[model samples]
Target: MTEQKRPPRAIGASGLSCFPIGLGCASLSGSYGPSDDDNALRVLHEARARGVTMFDTSDKYGNGHNEELLARAFGNARNSVLIASKFGNMAGKDGKVADNNPETIKAFCEASLERLKSDCIDLYYIHRIDPAVAIEDTIGAMSRLVEQGKVRALGICEVNPTTLRRAHKVHPIAAIQSEYSILYRAEAEDVLQTTRELGVAFVAYAPLGRGLLTGAVQPGSLGDKDERLRHPRFSAENLPKNLELAQAVQQVATERGCTAGQVSLAWLLAQGEDIIPIPGTKTLSRLVENIEAASIILSDAEIGFIASSIPPDAAAGLRYRAEHMKNMYL
Candidate 1:
C-alpha cells in the first residue's frame, strides 16, 4: 500500500515534530469493540510504514495490554516512533477510578517504561486531573521524571484553562490531549484557546466523533459489547440526532469526493497547524483513510460551511457519563 506523507506538526515547542495525524491505540484494548492482538499489532506496524510516528497509549488501557502490544509491534523500530503514554487513573480492586497523588509519579513512570520496553517516553501525559490533589504537586513530581530523562516532555488530558495554567506553572506543558471533533467542540475549543495562548500543542483524540462521524455507525448499531453503548451520545434517543450531524459531514464529503471521516478530520486540520489529531482504528484500511485525510485540503468557504454544519450544541447528550464527566476540563 502506498502511504501519503504529510507535513509534520510540533508538540508544543519541545522540538518534536510528528506526522499531522497520530494513531490512537485505545481500540487495541477492545475498548470500542473486541479486537485481536494480531490486528492490533498490524495496525501499529502499518501506521509506522505510513510515517505515522506518534502512538498514543495509556497504562490503564487494557490494563497494560495496549502498551505491551505497542512494544511487540515496534520492538526493533522503537527509536523511529514517538510513544505518548499516560499515568493517573488507577484501577481499584472494584475497577473504580482513583485520584493520582504526587508520591506515585516515580512508580508510575517506572512501570510505564517497563511496559513500553523503552528507556524514555517521548510525551507523558496525566490521563486525567485529580481534583483532590493540587495540580502543582502532581506536575512537580512529573517534572522530576523529565529531570531524570525518563520522559522527554510532559502533557495533560481533559484539562481546563485554570488547571492547565496551574500545571504549566509547575512545569512547562508540551501538549494537551482532549476529546475534540466537529461533533464536540465547546469544551475542547475552550481548552484549545488556553493551549494556544501558552504555545502548547493540542492533541485531538476522538477526532472522528467516536466513529459517529464516520458515516458507518447507525442508530443502535453499536453492539452491546461495545463501550460506546454506555455513552449518552450513542443512546437510542440521541443517536438519531447525532447521526444527523453525520449526514452534514457526509454531504461535504460527497462534494469533496472523500469519506465522511476524512471530511471530519480535514475540517480539524484546517483549524490550525498546531492542532494534531490521533484518529484510532483497528483496521489498516481505516488507518490509511485517516492518514490520507491530511492531504484533503479544505477551502476557506468549505471550512466555514463545515463549521456551521455542526455547531457546538448540534449533537445530543454529553460526551461521557455523568460520573466520568466530572474529571474533565478541571
Candidate 2:
C-alpha cells in the first residue's frame, strides 16, 4: 500500500506553526469513565512522538487534575509542544460559573502554569464568555497575561462572530476553539468565515462528534456516569437517528478503506487550511487512527458528497440541551 501524504501547513494567529491535526485531552481525564493515568500519559507521549505539536486541555477538566497529568507526561519536553488550556469555566457557589474577572484570570493562569509545570502557556483561552461581564473586559485581562510574558497567545471558545470581533479588538485572538465536525457544521459555515477573515485559526473540538462519527458508539454504549448519555443527541430516541448518519459515514469509509472516524476527520481537514481538528481519544490505537486522518486526503467531489450526506441540520437533537447550550456561543 502507498503511504498517504499529510496536508499542507496552517499557521496560528500567534505565528506558531503546528500540525494541522491536534490532540484534544478531554477524554484523557476520564470524560467517558475512570481513565488510567499511566495509559493517558503513554498516549500523550505517543501523540507527541507522532509529530502532533498542539495539545488542548482545560483547567476545569478533572478539576485541574488533567493539567497535572500533562505535567507528568510532558516534563522537560513541554517546550516542544504547544499547550492550550482554558479559563473562565470555574465551578462556584452558583454551580458552574463563567468568570473572566481580572483577578480570576490571573489566578487561573498561575494555577494552570503550576499544574502544567510550565513557565508559560502557549495558547490560553477564556473558555466561555461571562455574559454578565463585557467581552472587552475579559480579553483585556487575557491581554495583560501576554504583556506579562505568562501567556504566548489568546484564544476564545464557542464564541459567535460578534463576540469574536469584540474580543479581537482587545487582543489579537490566535485561535477560536469550537465544536466543529461533519456532525456539527453550523459554526464552520458562518463563524469560521469570520475567524478566517480576521486571520484567526479555528481549533475544532470534538472533531469526531464525541465518538459518534467513529462508528464505535452503539446504542447504550455510554455508561450512566458518562456525561454524553445525558446529552440530547445521545438520548435513546435520538441515538437511532444519529446512528443513521453514522451509517452514511461508514459507507463512505468502506469505499475509502478507512475507519468512519478517519473519513469524518479527513472531511474536516478538507474543509480549509485554517481549520485544525483536535479529536480526543484515550486509547493509543484510536489516537493513531485519529492522527492518520491527517494523511487521508479526500477529493473535492468526495468532500461535497460527505457534506451533502450530513447537512448541518441532518443530525438529530440539539448539540446541547438548553442549559448547557446557553453557556456556549456567547
Candidate 3:
C-alpha cells in the first residue's frame, strides 16, 4: 500500500536475508484468540505475496497446527521463503515453559521438518531455555542439526548475554528473537548491546506492543479466548497506564501522516539494520499496514522524541504474567 520499501536485511553472517519486516505467525494459530483455518491460510498466502520473506512459528503454537498451515499454504513454494520455527517452549503440567532436552532435539527437528514439509529449514531456534539443562548441551544438539544439513542457521529466543556467549561458543548463533518495540525496549536494548557486539541479528517480536501501540485494542475488546487477558501488560490495572504511554506513538502518527502501528514499527526499524520487526495481524488491512511500515523513515529528532516519550522502564506491568516471568531472559 505504501510507495516505499527497504532493501533485504541479512541474518548475521549466515548468508541468508529477508525483507525488513517479516510475518509473526503465532496469531494465525490462535495464540491471541480464536482463529479460522481458512482465513489463516489466506493471511499466510497474502503475506508471502506481499514480500514477507520470514515466517516465524513454533512447535507449541496450536500444538503444531501452525506449521501444518504453513505447509498447506505454501505447498511447492515453501522453499522460496524462510520459515523460522522453534521447539521446547511449550508449557508442561508443572506450568514451566521449556524442555530443551538434548535427547529429544533430533526427534523435535525431524517432526518439525515433517510438519513443515521442507527438506531443510531456513532457521531453527530454542524457543526457551530449560534451566535444568546445560546451555552447551542444548546448543550442541542444535549444532548437530546444522552438520547434518537439516537446518541452515541457528537462533535462540529469550536469551541473556552470558547464555548467548555460551551458546555461541558451541555454534555461531545467527539471530536472537525477543520482544522489542517502543513500549518494550528495556530488555531488547540490553540484548541488542550484546547482539551487536557479537554480530548477531536481532529478530524483534511483539513490535507493536501486543497491539497497544496500534491504538485499536480497547480495554474490553479482547475476546474471552484471547491470551492477552492473562498478560500483566493487559491487566485491568496496567492496561490503561500502558495505553496512556502508547498515546505518544499515536501523536507521532498524526504528525507523520501514518497509522500509529506504522510509527511503532518504523521506530523499531530506525533502531538498526540488524533489527527486524515481525508484527502479526489476522486482518488483511492490518497486515498491509505492517508491511508498509518498512517504508517509513523517521528523522533523528523524531526517533529520540518517541523513545523519550516512553521511558525504558515506564511500562506499568511485566511482559508476561508473574508466574511465567521467572523463565524469561535466561
Candidate No. with top lDDT: 3
Which scores better on lDDT, 1 or 3?
Answer: 3
lDDT (Cα, tens digit) per residue for candidate 2, span 1-330: 123676545555687868879999977888877789999999999999999999899998999999999899999898889899999887777775888887778999999999999989999998878888888988898899999999999999999999999989989999899999999878667898799889998888888898888878889778776789877888889988888987878887888788999989888888888888999988999989888888888877777888888889888988889788988887
Residues 1-330 of candidate 1: C-alpha lDDT, one tens digit per residue:
112445899999899989999999998999988989998888898889988989999988998999999999998989999999999877756665655688887898899899999999999999978777898999999999999999999999899999999889889999999999999999988888889899999999999999999978887577777999999999989999888877888988888788999989988988998889999999899999998998888788878887888888788999999988987888
For candidate 3, lDDT tens digit of each residue in 190-305?
98888998889999999999998898888898999999998888888998999999988998899878999999999999899999899988998899889988999888887889
Ranking by TM-score: 3, 2, 1
For model 2, give the RMSD to the true fold: 1.4
lDDT scores of the candidates, listed in order? 0.89, 0.87, 0.91
The true-versus-predicted C-alpha distance at residue 144 of model 2, in Å, is: 0.7
Candidate 2 ranges with C-alpha deviation above 4 Å: 1-4
Alpha-carbon error at 205 in model 3, in Å? 0.7
Least well predicted 10-residue stretch by lDDT in candidate 1: 1-10
Score candidate 1 by TM-score against the native: 0.97
TM values, all candidates: 0.97, 0.97, 0.97
Candidate 3's TM-score reads 0.97
Residue pairs clashing, model 2: none
